[model samples]
Target: MPFVNIKVSAPEPTKEQKKQIIAEVTDTLVRTLGKDPAAVLVMIETLEAESIGKSGLSLEDLRSKK
Candidate 1:
């Protein structure tokens, strides 16, 4: 079995987008690693902007600067 974990900060993905992500990831693993589609697991974790930081700035702060 192959496990794939993805983390995204804030503004969670829509249901359709998430499904596309899972499908694409599974196809990639199947084609590249020869993993069975049924055996491939994809997990997406959406974290709050406050929970993720970079360069001493939280994701929320960083996005605000944009």
Candidate 2:
């Protein structure tokens, strides 16, 4: 079994978008690693912008500046 964890800071993805992500990621693992699609697990986490930072700035702050 293969497990994939994805994280993003944002308002959150729509259900269709998330489904696409899951499908694509599963396909990638199946093709690249020869994993069984039924045995692969993909998890998506939507974190608070305030909790995710880059270059010393929180994602919330970065978005505000943009």
Candidate 3:
């Protein structure tokens, strides 16, 4: 079994995007490691932009710069 955990800052992915992510990740594990799709676990976690930072600036701040 393969477990994949993905974390993103704010503005979570849409349902269709999440579904695609799960399917693609599962397929990758199946193809590369011979893992069963049924046994693969994919988790997506979203955090507030304020909680995630880069270069000493929060993601929310970075977004504001854009």
Highest lDDT: give the candidate number.
1
lDDT of each: 0.95, 0.94, 0.93
For 1-66, candidate 3 gives per-residue lDDT tens digits of: 678999987699999999999999999999999998899999999999999989999999999999
User: How much does candidate 2 score in TM-score?
Assistant: 0.92
Distance from true position, residue 61, model 3, in Å? 0.7
| Arranged by TM-score, best first | 1, 3, 2
User: Quick one: how many clashes does candidate 2 have?
Assistant: 0
Model 1 misplaced stretches (Cα beyond 4 Å): none
What's the lDDT of the predicted structure labeled candidate 2?
0.94
Give per-residue CA lDDT, model 2, range 1-66, as digits (tens): 899999987789999999999999999999999999999999999999999989999989999998
Q: What are the runs in model 2 whose C-alpha is more than 4 Å off? A: none
Candidate 1 residues 1-66, lDDT tens each? 999999998789999999999999999999999998999999999999999999999988999999
Ten residues in a row with the worst lDDT in model 2? 2-11
- Alpha-carbon lDDT of model 3: 0.93
lDDT of 1 at 38: 98
Structural similarity to truth (TM-score) of each candidate: 0.95, 0.92, 0.92
TM-score-best of 1 and 2: 1
Q: What are the root-mean-square deviations of the candidates from the true structure over C-alphas?
A: 0.7, 0.9, 0.9
